[model samples]
Target: MTSIEPEQSSELVLRLKSGDVLAYEIIYNVFVKELLATAYKKTGDRVLAEELVQNIFISIWEKRESLVIINLRAYLFGSLKLSVINHIRSLVIENKYKEYKQVSFQEDYQDTSNLVDLQDLSGLIEEGLNSLPTKTQEVFRLSRYGNQSTKDISSKLKISEKAVEYHITRSLKRLKQYLKKFYIFLYL
Candidate 1:
């Protein structure tokens, strides 16, 4: 198995996107060892690094059809960085919870104004929600307010899970964009 050069990896990605198995093999051979090295550098644990590298390769293969890698090396490195950060963060949070029993909180304070703000925001949100497309709004509402899982909504609405996910993601993206615009307008 010949190791593909960095320039060749980009070509391999393009070919893989076009469903070329040889390109996939070439790309994997070139990047897999480097990816595992990055994982080991980030994690400082050989076993865990090996597992993360395995998952990363699996994810890459699974997503090959939709993958558009501008820089395969950078993407792999960034993924390894994020995976390590997530692992460390999870360990920190777990340790904090484990030690929570030893901490004493003798005083408790309550703020009534925060509750009022939440109520006002709830009303304002509902008033503006009608501006969204009906299907998008329904998907957003079911996922956010009705506390329904996407799978549940998909089954309830008789739509594919992908469609449900699309609607929900699109709805949230639009809402965020609108909110940013509104905030800018207010400042201007």
Candidate 2:
């Protein structure tokens, strides 16, 4: 790291807070490589580290007017650490979402092997539906099996749309609760 004298560093920080583009350029030139190296060491990805460092500089420039920096080097390193951590967290979340989507797609994919499971699940679902209140069971049947829209079901049943929605929601919740043990796959 290029060491700037304490007085000079403080002056540069004041100039940066005043929106002096020259001071900002000087700071960037001095700290960019060090920040890049720090990010690269942590992330172990050249492109990502470069992007992180670039983003830090961008943020500093954009928020320069409100920035309060007692020590330029320390502030730059702190920013780099935070950016790296956030990047890692984002990557982890993205990977988890991808995994979830892959598993969901696999489960949804139809195959001859799942035929028996589908039939059994249908029978179990029918049994659970039968156990619901008559109005709820009817609403659920019209919405799901009959593929009728909520508006159509409400009009046909002489009930408000909100009531139809409530019945369908209640039926689904009850069915899921009642068949929780036998329909383990449904939870996914």
Alpha-carbon runs more than 4 Å astray in model 1:
1-3, 101-188
Off by over 4 Å in 2: 110-188
TM-score of 2: 0.59
Best by lDDT: 2
Candidate 1 backbone collisions, by pair? none
TM-score of each: 0.48, 0.59
Candidates' C-alpha lDDT: 0.77, 0.88
Residue-level lDDT of model 2, residues 24-122, one tens digit each, is: 888998888888888889989999999999999999989988888998889999999899889889999999999999988887775544887777777
Model 1 global lDDT (CA atoms, 0 to 1): 0.77
For candidate 1, write residues 70-181 as lDDT tens digits.
Answer: 8887877777778788889999998898677444221112244456555655555665567778987898899999999989999999999999999988877767665665
